[model samples]
Target: MVLEENKTSSKAPVGEFNSSDLEVGGVVVYRDRAEVKRMIRVSVKKGENDVVVNQLPSVVDPKSLRVEGEGDAIITDVIYQSKTNYDEKTKGDKKQYDKLQDEIKELVEKEKFLTFKLEVITKQRTILNKFAEQICKFSDSSKEEKADMSEILKSGSVDGVMGFLTAYQDKMSHLDEQWRMHDREKTTLTEQLNVLRKNAQDLNPTTVKDAKTNRCVCISLEAASDTDVVLALSYVVSNASWTPQYDLRVFSNDKTMKVFYYGLIKQSTGEDWLDAKLSLSTANPSIGGSVPELGVQLLKFKQPVVVSKSKRTSHRINYDELMLCSSAIGGGLQEYDPTIEDSCLEELEQKSTGKAIAPIEITTTQVETNWTSVAFNIPRMATIPSDNTEHKVTVTSVGLKPEFEYAIIPRMSSHTYLQAVVKNTSSYALLSGPANVFLDNNFVAKSSLKDVSPSEEFHCSLGVDPSIRLTTIPVKVLRGQSGLISKSVTVDYRHMFEVKNTKQEQVKVTLSEQLPLSTDERIKVHLNDPDVRKVNTPVNLPFGTVTLNSSNNLDWVVNIPTNTTQPITLTYSVEYPPGHVVQGLPKN
Candidate 1:
């Protein structure tokens, strides 16, 4: 933001105040209002003096202004007001709107000329094409009407009609080239004209209006005998904000992943911040500051009402009662599971039962108050312009030991996705923000972060990997079953998954599969799990019931060794009364 200074005197000046050096100390950025802090050094004589600090954004709320005086100087009053001048420009910048309007007029005339030329070229090209098409019919038309081409050829004497036809062909080719040139010129002229029109859009009738110069903060001070004082001022202003971003990089040889945290700062606050120490906070200054007071409660009696006659269904699906786990598709199916879902994650106090992985360590200089919010203090000062452009600054970097896995849902997608799972082990909380994922120095995909606490684990997608392949096919199918007393019908489907790892290195994969859910007690569904312990060395095991969050789907974490192929099977059966039929089955 641009800044200017103004000083004024009233009556006989009893003291002279000097203030030249003003430094921006810190800035606490909120969602809407930012708390700006500035420190200025002052020296004054032994009597009353007038001091004014000018050049601030007009959006600053006067009620939120604050001032502090050090040393023996006692501040009598602080006032906020606007400052405007009669003329702010010389003759060169006097009629700014008139200048833009003149430029627009010149460009518009150029555009008209280009358009006319393009139309002429288009007409010429159309006529040439028509003549070329009729050239083939000249032999037939000449025999019925005038001199034929054969007669002209027999009596080739002086007229040179052959030269005329050749010249016409040459002219048509030249026009074809000229037509393309005119079209490009027209496109360029149109673009230039549009830019000029946009520039002159705000100037109606070619007149410029005077704008407010700036805002000022005036202070009346009294210093006791040549005292030096330090004054601090802070206020809230709009049009300034910052958002968090992350860059996560994983290496081929290293087990730990590196996370580079950043914040994108932007402002159109009418003034630029130059060489200022920036602090990003997750606080909103507009959320009211006053403490709440308790009030007395009173109760009243009323007549009872009647109930409606609508009974509930017995086969209703209570989605709320079904506490789904955290890994519910990872795409907005956020049914919160009261119980822990990952068999690798036991109780908070107990270690995981699966194969042990390394721990992640975070490093940063940040101040966190709650699990949902944190503030970052930038180590170095920066200069951000007031042009509403993004400027990214590194907040901190942390090293995370993430477990890599390939997750897939064969029914929904044929390709398997690589996922990196890790916990936020930093002392500070990680806010929700956009993240860029990278692997082995190559950019993978864009992801996002959510509210994660110190030890809360979150999933980050590493995009699709082509080395590992999977195929699913129906291996067994059975239909029609009957009994005498308890007559029933049954159908069984056995799905087989064939997987292969073509890469030279071993890969860890997690496959997510779903089973059909039965809402009625009479309808039953069953699953048969095949043992997959022979797949890997320390054999990936199913620690707990993977079908807790869902009645049908199961999750399997597998480690595929290099140049290895394996097959896994899961069977599900549906049974119902003999006379009943299912509605949503495949046509085949």
Candidate 2:
């Protein structure tokens, strides 16, 4: 953001205002808004001096403005207003706008020429590739067709055909190189046009009937003597936010994990924060300050209310379309160019994970905790443009020793998933957000993290592991008649699950299963096999322990030895009177 200053007498015309040169000092970004602080030094006479801070972003909240400073002056009043002017540009601004327009025209023409050249090159390359393909198929054709297509075949012998292919490959390569060069030049031209257009737009912004509007803060104070006073102003602005993203790197050998916390900050507040101190907060100012109150409840007869449908037209511009226009005019985000190379993130996974790794430059943040929210203050200055794009910053990183285990629900899926349980040891709190999980420096899966305070434990799924195999056998059902007087029917159900651990180390696995719960009094359901008649109690088995809850859900925690196979069986029976039907009973 640029600021201009002009000094005038206190008795100047009513419409004219004295402005000060303000510089952005720092910013505190929250969930939906940011608090910006600006500072300025002003020389005031002994009498009353009105100082105006000009060129503040229009998105600022007028009610959130605050002014604080220490000097031998008595601060009286402060006012914030949206100022509008007609024909505000001077001769110099007009000259610069014309220059930018000329530059833009030149760049656009060059871009058009480059695009046309690239298209020609692409067509030539395609033709060359097709010719090479047809020439290679010449030898495979029959003699009758070869004689008919002899003119199409450039060479007679295999070696001659090979020579033609090699030459074609060279020509195609050269065409491809030329295409790339022209494409890069076109991209460069587009960027130059964007910059020039942005400059032109800044000089002549869109307004209502040629009127330019901006925000300014006015301060009224009385100085004891002629002196220079430093003024600090702060305000809240919207269209700024930060979201949390985490990278969890798991070291399989050490059974440890390192969490690289990052905050993706985005802002379109109409001012760039260049070399400004930035702090990210977890607070949401949009929710308001006071607590919500509940209204009195009333009940009455229901009545239908008729809603009239009326057609209304909106004058607001679509944001996506505006962004496209801005990109074309060099005032918005750049277009996606496929000619540019991708990031080096793919190099993280190679043939060998033991290769030498490059040291990453990591930035640390200072944690500031409060009763309502936690803030991460970046230690260094940052430059963030007002482009509304994601700017990732490293918040902090912590290493944790995690407990590993395998979990499976054979009824749902036969694949066993590896799980990691870790505690948040750092003082900072982990907010709920998306995370990327990497095992042994290779990306495994994308997961989400819940809100975890300091010293709180959390679980992360590390995806399926094939080494721990699980198999589900067909369920067995048996039915028979019992109770001679009533002739009741008894149905028996059995479930068998097999697990084989091929890993060299012993592993612990948790298997979950469920039993049917009876809702009627006459229909009785109970576990017959491996039944201890105890609910909410873990019964010890030879391989593991199984616990049954009131909901008829069973959880078995088993520790399997290396290279060993274990079989788990569960049986339950449902009994009902003759001629009575059970809806969910298993069939043989």
Candidate 3:
């Protein structure tokens, strides 16, 4: 990575000066910290040379700094120190910021003036309208040939009154036109002011310490002979990261789901990663080394740990401290533990920002992802700014065959839900992320995906399915009366469920219904039906054993053939002592 040739100047009595040979060549963005790799190209003379790379981020962890070169030179020491470049730039930007503030003030004052002008015009128009209405009334009453003389002479003769009204009418018309012009101008100015304000906000550095001074790492080299030195310096930087994003487009007709893998990258580490090669990973240098610690532990039963009921907000806001996993300069360790909480507050955060980012067309080579933690080597050079905007990037796309089914819980909801059960066939671990679901190219709603390992099957709701019709009705009503045999009351109830599948494909349905339970012996409830039809669940599954819950509820996982109607009946009866009404019995 040869940046440029070496040059020396005697203007500042330069014995050891900063070199312009260093350039940010690549960046490996992780869940938190980003590893910035810089290339230093220098032509070394046959002597000891001291050169510094002045374009390093201030958030660079001191322990994560590394420098190595391939030339006739031995790397001695690398030091990170403060300089005046960043401070000087900050001072220049402050002046521009002040100028922008003045512009905003001027715009605000102009808006106020224009608003007041519109108010005055409005008042004048109102007064003219009232006078015109009175004139109309006088004209209407004069047909009697005997109008009120006092009203007629209020503004002198009739001609005089007419001329006064006419002149004021023109005046009001002109004022209305002026108001329209002023309103347009005010709107334009307000928009301009808003854009400038947004620019001002984006231009300001995120951290005061980073903006204060230039933090550069300098290295001294002892050259054995004259040669061109190729050096690579890599350091860990904060305030820059990437998280997973996904788009699931379901082709209902084709019975397939297209999953688009995306990356939401934000860089606020002060320096722009312009035209730098990018590699997004789940690696984190903060957790620990790559080597696993093996220790013996005994498992014993104890009191369960009480987890907090509150959401883990730190997963969205805070990051763990960076601890370097570097054993040496060039040779380092990678410990991957992605710390991103992607799906929880994505909608809320997006609403707060008031900005929209269009989805990127996901594309990547087949070799981009691998086992365990996936790595995406971006093919093209990227220029990511430091405004903390979520820049979208393409990763990969996969088409999956999913089994679509309709599920109903009549006890809970009257609506039927469409669920897709798909296997995650890709090698990449699908970190939990917010997903936008589309059915046949029409956007359905916003949903989320759970963390699923490769080859694991997971299901997500795709919202209500209107094609499948379902209805639940009571066939037999609950009745209780005292019997002669034993002064007890008995009630019988039956609930019937009918499902009509309209789809062309054969679908499996899962329906759950509950029955009343009796904890006390005197208030026992018995099911009237002798036996219920057994479900043809998979042989590998142990769904044949039906154990009603202690709550007296049981789930029925049934399969409904395509283009057909299926009716299921659940019958039960409750009996209690006379004068002791059964509470679980339905009124119907």
Candidate 4:
């Protein structure tokens, strides 16, 4: 006989499970559907013993008894209470175990997914850190890179790693566009700030207009004449945010007189205003009179007068019939007005009080002119009549003016005349007779004069020889009783002289004694050589030695020897007596 049994197994589906056997309470179990379908299977070909059933004693527990059959048998518990207790305990415990196992499996799977997400996030964080580090390094390299880094960093977002990256890219693009738009604005604002700072530095604290202060101006005018007029006007400014450029309009009644525009204060130093003037012919003749009384008005501004692309304003000052006067009364007034004098004094006092002080005064005088006369004694040159050799006649004076303008006139012969006008006044009077003249120690001519005045005239005559010689005429004048008079003028004279070669072979002469000398010394020199003739003294020698020339009548001849290397010695002496020393020295 075959017996059937029902079985239950707690395992996964066959395909889902890895193993078919299972252990429960130290018992290994196989998962098989055939075993579960049948409780026993019998084989009939094999011999099997028959089983007899007997009544068990009441002392044996029926729950512990079991039976073995030749074919598998299904055992049924007779003790239902005990089976029911076992089933209840097993079912409760198994259900709890299965629940715990399912919970652990689910937790493990969740942990694996979390770990994968952590890895991805960590990797992304590392890339971001590296990118930030590279950006920092590049910024530190140069100014250009620093600017680029600023742009990049400004675009970064504070989101999750990948989201932050995408946001950062989008932000970077947006930031680049903003920079292009705002760059010009930012530059303009910066330049304006700099210009404001510079202007503040250059400006002074105290100015014509202040935001938090009040100001006042005082004007005063003085009238010189009754017709002179004066007028003034003023205006009040309020709530001026900036020192605005404005155009001021001036009017007379309803007529527009002038317009003035205020310039930039930064380029200007003072307050800008327009001043005008008008004349009054009559006080009140008619409303539309030809010459009307002067009227004045002012128009202030509250808005800026913008001068585009221009630095200076075009406003100009208008001056109407403005007349300047000096006198107070007219020419028709006859006598001096006492009231006018008092008014003038009062005006002067007021002006003096308003101004500075004046300086002190000192006295002065003029000079007077004094006059004197002068005379000179001239020497006359002797002429040689015998030999056909022409002789030079010269008249020289010692005390005469060295430089004087003179007109020489020959009273004897008007045809062969000589005239010299003495422009220079001297301290001595003129001589009476003819006088000899010598120039550069040579005979020149003779001159004679009767008298000489302040701008007097003198006369002289001369004969010139063939030889040319340089000569200067000298004159001697007497000392006057008056003070010394010096005059600078040109000396004019008609005279000529002959020059002869006096130098010959060297001559040696000896002198015994020195001769008496005078200021005007006339002498004749003779030489031992036949070719040598008489000649005047070459120069004025001092009254000391006689070794330079051989004295012959207070004179000496100088000559040079031909083909002779030896030098010639001339012995001469001079004796100058003490003469009257003229107080005034003659001016040359």
Candidate 5:
């Protein structure tokens, strides 16, 4: 019995079936070439009975089958238990799939509803467009009507249109208004979004980091020593996030108090850059206003200053020695150095400490003394005794200290007198007695003195002969045993002497003379033809030897020969016994 396997068109061999063609509950089989050929032939022979043929078993008796002609075949049963199981699973899957299909259909219906709503909205938009066109047409038709309509709309009035049209128009207007408001809201929201975006973009991390990475430092001058100066550095971070560290140093070229400040600052943010500033000030005191204008300029500082070295020199003067010499020259002496004291020396020391020092040696030089004299003439008529007689006169020096001399002379003025100060080196005062004074070999006057002190002074008036040829008055002083003594010393004192010559012609005469005379002896002379010559004779001649009984006149006579210009001389002697005590002249 050769049972043929039938193949259905839709259910042919399941060889390498794709998922699109394969179905659940189907069976597949692997077959050799001969079996496949045989199956195909059998399906062709019983096309209409393929189903029945497939149900029959395909058999060529295995024992009679040639191994060469037979090949192994893998059969897939389309209706076996596996097929049943696969069919049952497929049926269950179909039910679940149908449920899912129903859900998809519901979602499709909802999408159709939303599409219909979109279509309605489109139709409404068209209607609104038509209404807007009508409104534009009306507005264009008449300006007055358009203005009225615009005013009514602006006033929120909707009474102009008919009922349903009004309602639809109102709905449409409401929708339009809502759309416009929404658009405005959207525009505002968009603008805000743009601003936020811009702000976000502008936030640059690099720039912020750089700002936080830098700092500045400043150094200020504090103080200085001989070799180095101290400075204080203040570090300031521009950004608060940064703190800086600095390495500070001072540099200078000067050996004393010279310095410069330098430093580097690093940001605490670990940055690589720094900045700094430096300021300097001096420690010296400004000059005071007490100095003179020029002196202040001299003391002005032109550059930076360091320590100052004193350059002062000491100067000294001996007030005591100067006083002594000055007193000896008739200078008035007063107490000196009473104002200088220890306090003054201390002040001087303090002042000199900072000043330039200099060595000073002082030596004293004396001031010289000067003396001057002026004279006036005394007239012959002004003589003390009116009678013209030759007498020995004396004049005592006056008005000056001891050791000084003076001379009495006739002045040029009539009846005037002249006196002269004489230089003296002696330490004693001068004294004399009354004797005859002469001028031009003629008698002039007489002089005398009493007691006078060294510091005391006096004034005298002497006579001159108008007829005598005399330029000065000649006075005589008798040297006494008692001499003058000087009492005091002085510095630079002055004595004034005055002389007067009465005669018109210049008269020449011996100014002073010394004579020896007695205290009471009187000598007289016989004047032969005395009327031809004027005689200024002394009242008493203290030296002579003659008979007193002979009219108190002397036998000695001075003869005046006619027309002769010879001067006469007479000699007389006086004696004072020895062993007489004499007092020294008074100081003046």
Candidate 6:
């Protein structure tokens, strides 16, 4: 697409070397790279006019550079190169570097002078301390010696001993004040030297190798007529990137939630994007755009190979590495895999530089969805500095109606967990990311959200809910032998669970329990208490409805009344031939 041009009041005179005033007009940040668009308006002559655009980031990919313009101008050719100013010592950055060095040298000299003055004051103070000690010793001497000292002082002083002491006090006070002033000066000089030295280092020769070595674009365009042409230049840079984040605010009373979507951007591209139009995309250009092709598969007979035990090795895939490969193959971020070890994941997260941002209310932005990706246009102009810090911007937020229910697995834990099922109603697609869940203005838990499309539903688990209490009664196992003639064996099992709701309003709970499934051909299993065989067939009880799923798990959906308790009982038995053992049975 052709870039949109902005108008400018300044123009270049004809037949003159003109440097274009390029400003960053827009930036579209992707998963691992960013596309920067610059705009300028310049007047051109009838023939070919050479326009030079300098101060481009060094990380800009020259291959991806493109120039588009409007007005009566035919673009000829563009030359991209790194403009090095290493030899021009009297111009631009070299002069600045020299100035910084001079300032630093001057400050260092002043610092040395202050240090000398402070040393002199310290010596004077030390002499004054010695004189005071001598006078104290004279005052503690015998009366005859004291009298002799007084006579000597009176003979030498024009005033008296008191006047002599006053003079000494005045001199000491003056020295102390001078020392304080010199110390303050020294501190100020040290601070100035630090600042100047830092500035000089930034402008040093290596800076010329890095920062001053800028990418420049020279465009030679032919104008059909003398007119002002608006040019838009775009290029891709690899140093800027963004990742998706989310905030889920749940309202339990209304059964609704608001999902705030954000993009965390980090860029160190050596150029500040000030008040530029910003957009976030889910595309990762680093993995390339070519579709992968598969070769024909050939079948061969299996062969066995033997190896020494000492020479054999085992290689296991790491969770983070596997996830990284999966994300690369998926074209975007992949869903969170719970199979990853929590300790490993937590350690990796702790080591990451990206920090969690506090939640805030935000307005939704405009979204554009395509067949393969989606882009969000920020509503206002964004300013991102060259410092590599996470700058989070609100992409969009949507209010979703959620279905809330409590899930209880008494076999694993007695605590009941609240879960919410939400459907994406907005036009923007949701990428996989970490989400912070807040319940009625209080933070409850942190959950991971999977990639979801518009009109798709996903579930989020809010941590344990203490309002509903659950108790699992101990299971009773009755082992006996039946059919004496055939010598058969039968084992009976019984389980009971108690659920109590303490809330003022009724709550829905899903209680799940596991039952043993026989793998042996001679073993027979039967449900004696609550007979059920078909799936989705509800067995209605006084408190709830029970359903036996294909996984040999019994799920009960119960609506417990306020301040009431409900009890659920499950009974089953296993029949096997004599001298045969049964596994997976409860120990107690």
Q: On residues 517-572, what C-alpha lDDT tens digit does candidate 3 reach at each position?
A: 67789986777652533343222222222334444565555566678877766788
- For model 1, residues 1-588, the per-residue Cα lDDT tens digits are 122234444534332222113577777766565777777666767878656667767667666778886888888766666655434552334366568778778766776776665565555555444433444555556343334434433443323334435566666666667668867877887787777666566543323354435576676777778877777777777888888787787775766677777778887776667788887887665677787999999889886998755332222222222112111111122121111112211112224776554544433456747444467777778887779887776677777889887887887898989888998787656678888887875778888999676788999999988788998775577887867788888888787787789989888776766666777777777655543222122323443223323333566666778998766667777888877767644222
CA lDDT of every candidate: 0.64, 0.75, 0.67, 0.26, 0.26, 0.75
Q: Candidate 4 residues 1-588, lDDT tens each?
A: 211122222322111110111110111001110000001121221222112112222122222233322222222211111111224544454455555555555544544544444443343334444554554466345665556545544444223223544454554454345444445544554555455444443332322122122121111112232222111111211111111121111121232211111111111101211111101011111233366668888798789898677321121111110000001011021231100011110111124458734422211111122232111111221211212222221111112332211111112211211122233243323334344333322335554445444356453333332221222233222222221363222222222211122223232221121222233442112222122233332443332222223443322222214333222222222222233342222322
Give stretches of model 5 more than 4 Å off.
Answer: 1-90, 142-161, 164-169, 173-588
Looking at model 4, residue 119 earns an lDDT score of: 43
Q: What is the TM-score (0 to 1) of candidate 3?
A: 0.56
Arranged by TM-score, best first: 2, 6, 1, 3, 5, 4
Provide C-alpha RMSD values for all models, in order.
22.6, 21.3, 23.1, 65.2, 65.3, 23.9
lDDT of 2: 0.75
Quote each prediction's TM-score.
Answer: 0.59, 0.66, 0.56, 0.13, 0.16, 0.62
Q: Point to the candidate with the largest TM-score.
A: 2
Per-structure clash totals for the candidates? 6, 1, 0, 57, 76, 0
lDDT of 4 at 141: 57
How does candidate 2 fare on TM-score?
A: 0.66
Structure candidate 1, residue pairs in collision: 1-271, 1-272, 2-271, 514-553, 515-552, 515-553
Whichever of 1 and 3 has more TM-score, that candidate is 1
Q: State the lDDT of candidate 2 residue by residue for 1-588, as single tens digits.
A: 112223233443112232223566889999898998877677778868777766778787777888887777877777666756656454456667778888888778778777766765655555455545555665786776566455433223355445546576565666677778878888888888888888798765343256667677667778889888777788888999999888888988768898888778899988888788889998887889998999999999889998966321121223343233223222122232311122222224433767766645566688888889999998878877899998877787787999999999986898999999898888889989998888997779999999999999999999999999998889998889898687889988999989999999999999988888888989998787677577899999888899987777888899999999989888998899988778976656
* Model 6 spans with C-alpha error above 4 angstroms: 1-21, 82-213, 286-291, 294-363, 481-489, 517-544, 547-552, 574-583
Residue 218 displacement in candidate 4 (angstroms): 99
Model 5 TM-score, 2 decimals = 0.16
**Model 1 global lDDT (CA atoms, 0 to 1):** 0.64
